[model samples]
Target: MDTFVWRDDYSVGYTPIDEQHQELFKRINAFGNALWEGQGKELLAAHLRFLADYVVSHFQTEEGLMTTHKFPLYEVHKPVHDAFVQEVSSVLNRIADAGLDTATAILVFEKSCDWTRAHVRGMDQELGRFLGAQRNSTAA
Candidate 1:
């Protein structure tokens, strides 16, 4: 797996969101390292659960910020988060049922990493701009 690398471009211009984003990458890397060590199966379920829980926490943070700021896109954005949550839930069930291998574990990591990069580059950037403008206007 090409590990998730945090680029400056990934920053959402919001400290909390950016920090959480970085944390997500860090966790993914740690999980990848475990896979590298051949501990993927033993740890896969725990890792997925942890990731799913962490993602929900991060989503809550974003949702709170959007509601507090009255972001216009909250309606559109939140359902995306919901869908990801459901996807993770489905994967967790699949892993439980089939007993995943190292390859499948790696695919989970890759898909999550890809999703995050795209989400951050897309909607989250727009959110960052909106929040930054809000901050600036309030300060002014």
Candidate 2:
């Protein structure tokens, strides 16, 4: 499995958001590591729960900032967040409820990592650019 590493380019121009993103990666990486180590359900579940819960909190922070700043693309962007939350929530729930076999565990890690990389590179980078432009304009 490809590990999630925080890259300098991943910064979204905001310190808090960037920090949270790094933390998100950290949590995901921990989850992957636990799974790879063949850790038992309790350990894996703890990491998965952390990922799910942190993601929800992080989304709230981003959405709040977008709303406060009146980000032009917020309406378009928010649904992405909602969908991700639902997806991750379902994965976490499935693990919690029915327990995950080896295959399912790997699937969860792959899905989380793939989605995160794409979203950060695409929609999130756009938001970061918008925020940066807004800052520059206000400074001028």
Candidate 3:
């Protein structure tokens, strides 16, 4: 499996979020490497656990930024986060139920890659623009 690489264009224009995004890419890549190497189920489980934990922590960081900045789209934005959490949680649950088989691992990897790209490009970019505009106005 080819690991997902973090491109410069994917940045959300915030240091913390960008850093977390990079970390996510690294984690996903590690997960892929483990899958390719046919590592033990425990190793795969560790990566999945990291993904589960990151989803919670990273969402909180993003949502807290939205709340603090009084971003008008907070309500709408949160449901997107919620839905993603649900999706990831579902995959985690599937792993628990079915074990870290090939299909399950592939499902987790594909879903993570897809969601990360779409969310960052769509919702997060909008947030970044709003934040940039806010900073500019405050500076002026």
Candidate 4:
């Protein structure tokens, strides 16, 4: 699997959330690189641990903001986050049980990267627009 690259086009124009998303991409990419480089199982496991923690925290932050703003799509958007966490947990469990193999782990990691990009583009961008418009309306 190729490394996931962060592109400016993914920005949602919300500084805090955008920064968090960038950090997420960086961590995930680092994990992928480490996996590809044939890092030791212990090291790769550590990276995956961090990734899992960060993903949960980041999604919660975004969800909290959406709830606070009463974003119309919050209900729809939340299930995506829940589903992602479940999927990541399942992968983590498998790795724990079956032992981490570079090929298998890398494939799952790449799928996650793709999911992140698509989610940011599809759901996150829309949420960002909604939040931004709300801010502008309040300011006016």
Q: What is the TM-score of each candidate against the true structure?
A: 0.92, 0.92, 0.91, 0.93
User: Please, what are the lDDT tens digits per residue for candidate 3 over residues 36-130?
Assistant: 89877767877888877987898899899999999999999999999888877876776675558766787778878988898888898888888
* Predicted candidate 2 versus true structure: per-residue lDDT over 23-125, tens digit per residue: 9999899899999889887778888888888999988998898998899999999999999888877777777766666787788889888999888878888
Ranking by TM-score: 4, 1, 2, 3
- 122, model 4: CA deviation in Å? 0.7
Once superposed on the true structure, which residue ranges of model 4 sit more than 4 Å away at CA?
none
- Candidate 1, residues 1-140: lDDT per residue as tens digits? 53678999999998989999988888777777777778756586677677778899999999999999999999999999999999988888888855558898888878988999999999998999999999999999
lDDT (Cα, 0-100) at 96 in candidate 3? 76
Q: Against the correct fold, how does model 1 do in TM-score?
A: 0.92
lDDT of 3 at 41: 71
Better of 2 and 3 by lDDT: 2
Each prediction's whole-model lDDT (CA) = 0.86, 0.85, 0.83, 0.87
* Order of quality (lDDT): 4, 1, 2, 3
| Pairs in steric clash, model 3 | none
State the weakest 10-residue window (summed lDDT) of model 3.
Answer: 94-103
Reference-based lDDT, residue 88, model 2: 79
Error of 4 at 24 (Å): 0.3
lDDT value, candidate 2, whole model: 0.85
Clashes of each: 0, 0, 0, 0
